[model samples]
Target: MTRRNIEGSFHLSGGDFTNAGAASSELKSILTNLGINPEIVRRAAIATFEAEMNVIIHAVAGVMYYLITQDTIKVVLNDMGPGIPDIDRAMTEGYSTAPDWIREMGWGAGMGLPNMKKNSDRFKLDSVVGEGTTVEIIIRIKEGKTE
Candidate 1:
């Protein structure tokens, strides 16, 4: 069995709009520097960005874990905040609970979760109404070559 390569972890503070995409950006840079495929890196970055934004917009605090292996890059985002009441509803496009102020900041179009799912090769989400949410995003890295 192939061993897992744990890359790093990032801590995100809820409502910290000033640093919303920082973690995602750093992940992208790290992957790029590691000579990963651009396309796979792009997908991972987008998924990470969406997850990070969700933490900033909704959660009280969160941690993002980055893991890599011979053929995959996985990101796990765990948050503490008011969790999703309905994962189904939250998955719907154009469905959001963000306040008007958030929208005014040009975000919260309800696309975060959906976009994350779309970009990842595998996705999983878990939430508790009064607790928090956790999202796992995996992007399969192409073997034997970098494009």
Candidate 2:
């Protein structure tokens, strides 16, 4: 037997809507192959997708790093861009700073942060107004959920 762990990282470029959600989709596939619970996978996918989109919509570049285990899926998104000025307002489901063009494409509906928090068992968001933002999402897998 060899030693291994389920982990991966992906990079994203700002305004690259063409590749949005790719990383999250890969995560879903990995978790499915590992026999993790579908529900957990779904939540992780949604949360990660939202986080990924956030970086694409607002940052110059970003990376998503994830670690999976028998008990949890942990995802961290780090980006370089104009950080949130008001986390509270940003967390509101209907408030978005996304430009009109993004909304015209049917995104930036202001649900990203809210939805991310909703699907994560643990959520942490930090930002510097002019620096960047970092988000961590952790989802717990029940005892029998991992095979």
Candidate 3:
């Protein structure tokens, strides 16, 4: 839990497929400029992109908050979408509720949560049926670390 003051936000549109990765890319650029490790930056960027995609293809709209510190980056994604009825099922690889159209866009491969988990040092989610969903991810900046 590295501590330092940090802040950022990513806004995701409901159907912004054309610009899905923009926010993540911007954050990656910022992190890179901050001298963060490339691998850590990649993991954080990929995870953020996946979350943004989820908002587009599923949630319709959402916001991602970032907390940067000396050694770690924390991301919190919140969305007003059809909540996951079963967290266990959703966490499994190859599980997706995206329609065929979204799949056609190459946006939904049932890998959102799994990829986030794989890329983050810590991953957690809270969702309620008919309510919404929130996901938290933490990535640590370090040298010679591979993920």
Candidate 4:
């Protein structure tokens, strides 16, 4: 965008697989229209989708906040659900806490967090056992040509 930065938010509901990827798709369209680099857009899209899916699968409810600037794309997904008790274990690639029903539906293979981290230039995740989880992912635009 021409402005200094753009901000937006998306609401999410757990177990609502019908509209799970809507937020990320909308974000992708926005970035594409804004003329962001393809590589940067791809990374942001991957991270954003992963974060959105995490909330949909694990949280009772949540919101994803995004900030787009000339230098970076940042998205923070905050969920109100059973918080993760082990951040380190959750970060592992092949680990998942998704229920059998979810797995039967072809999700929760345990790559969500890892994919988010891999696609992010910067990533931070925080959770409280009974509170919720907050994941922040930042994808840096190229140093130049980011108007």
Most accurate candidate by TM-score:
4
As a whole number from 0 to 100, the lDDT of residue 65 in candidate 4 is 95
A best-first ranking of the candidates according to their TM-score comes to: 4, 2, 1, 3
TM-score of 4: 0.93
TM-score of every candidate relative to the true structure: 0.92, 0.93, 0.90, 0.93
**Per-residue lDDT for 1-147 in model 4, tens only?**
356788999999998999999999999999998898888898899999989988999899999999988788989999998999989999999899999888898878999999999999889999998899999998888665432
lDDT of 2 at 77: 97
lDDT against the true structure, per candidate, is: 0.91, 0.91, 0.85, 0.91
TM-score of 3: 0.90
If both were scored by TM-score, which would come out higher, candidate 1 or candidate 3?
Answer: 1
Q: For candidate 2, lDDT tens digit of each residue in 1-147? A: 322567889998998988888989998999888887899899999999999999989999999999986678899999998999999999999999988999998888999999999999899999998899999999997654542
Looking at model 3, residue 86 earns an lDDT score of: 90
User: Ten residues in a row with the worst lDDT in model 3?
Assistant: 138-147
